[model samples]
Target: MNTIVSTYNLSKYFNGICRVNEVNLTVYEGDIYGFLGPNGAGKSTTLKMLLGLIKPTKGNMVIFSKNFNKNRQLILSQTGSLIESPSYYEHLTGLENMRILQRLRNVSNKKVQEALHIVRLEKQQNKLVKHYSLGMKQRLGIAMALINFPKLLILDEPTNGLDPNGIREIRELIKSLPQRYGITVLISTHLLSEIEQIATSVGIINDGNLLFQGSMEQLKAKNKAYISIKTQDNNLAKKILLTEGYKFKQNNDRLIFEDLTDSHIAYLNKLFIGQSIDVIRIEEHRKSLEDIFLELTGKERSL
Candidate 1:
């Protein structure tokens, strides 16, 4: 796939404090790239730099295969972003609000209508902004961003304060953008479950550092499988495992070890029975994506 955006050693410092430190981000065309992190983990700062809303203290960015600094105007003309919250006139109708942006971007009224429809706000376009629900407000923000029919869209924590139903609506709209409008999306959020559902690629950040970045399958594969066994005597099992050159963790009466194949499991069962050790039960478990996300982010609970 074509590279839509790439950053090298991107760093942002505020008042001599590093908010984003030596981070590299890669966004490909047709990808819903999920920038996952805890709150205050520099996600917003990094995105602001990408949009040129703030300058990076050091490092470089390339957008659409052009140097972003050299081609700022051209890049931004094709890029749309809703960083933080979008401002709107509460008394104005959604359609009127969209028209203001249409005039600003010099786009036709058709683009405005198309954006509102894509966000499923066509029916609510004539309603006053104050009458719109939280979900409708967010969709209006997105509609404003899409008024220019941008090729790349960046959203910073768009689902920040929505309920379950609202979240689902936004999630569906984001997931459909790539296929429907050929737009590449870079969305930052604290919710891993939402990322797991909507993102084709993932970037995990914490403490102003980028910890992991890869495809969703790669992140999911980081979860390791383990075998937990209960025996009549766990101490004996530990000793036997140690004597047999195996590593394990013990908790109370249970012994846990890394994943063993079916053949290895059979061998262990036969060996234990031959040694007159009565086995209780052995169960396999895999670490969840949430667990890995927490471990990587040091239990920062923005999610």
Candidate 2:
């Protein structure tokens, strides 16, 4: 895959401390690259460096194959972004806000209208931004980001202040960008579940370090596999599984085997049937991205 964005040994300093240390990133065309980390994990700092809003202390950053530091105008023309909260004139209507951005980007009013349609904010185009809910404001932010029809869109926590419906809307909007508009996206957020649903690839960062970078499927596959089996005699099945030397976990009435193969499962089913133990259900339990992240990061998260 050809890289649309690449960073080499990128480092940023704040008060002589490395905020983002020796990082490398690759974002390909037509990819929604999820950049995920906890709060204060240097996500914003790295984005600023990439956008040339802040100068890097060491290493190089390139966008669209151009060094952002040297070709700032060229990069800006091809890219659109919403970093942090997008602020608009409190008194301005949604249309007005988009018009201002379009003017600045040297784009047409039709482009602004198209962007509003993309974010599903066309009906609220005449409403004052102050009257818009947080979710609406986020949609407007995305509208502004799309006003230029940029080849690459950088969104920092695109669903930060959205409600469930708004989050769903944004997720659909992001997913449609590559196919509908031929736009690639690089989105930064701490919401792993959201990333799992929308991103084609992900880069996990923590404590200013890039821990892992790969597809969500690849990350999920890194964790151990487990086979879940439900039987009439839950306790007896658990006992049999343990006695048979299968490493397992108990989920409600189900006994899950950590390393059980198809043949092993079949054998267990036959044994249970012979013993008059009804086999209720059986399946391979696939680990989620969150499960893999917990194992890799060694951190516990509560719902």
Q: How badly does each model clash, as a count of residue pairs?
A: 0, 0
Which ten residues in a row are the worst by lDDT in model 2? 294-303
Candidate lDDT scores, in order, read 0.92, 0.86
lDDT of 2 by residue, 185-265 (tens): 999988888888999989988778888988877776686778888888888876776787767778777786777778888
lDDT of 1 by residue, 120-211 (tens): 99999999999999889999999999999899999999998999999999999999999999999999999888899999999999989999
- Winning candidate number (TM-score): 1
Residue 243, model 1, lDDT: 89
Mind sharing the TM-score for model 2?
A: 0.83
Q: Once superposed on the true structure, which residue ranges of model 1 sit more than 4 Å away at CA?
A: 242-252
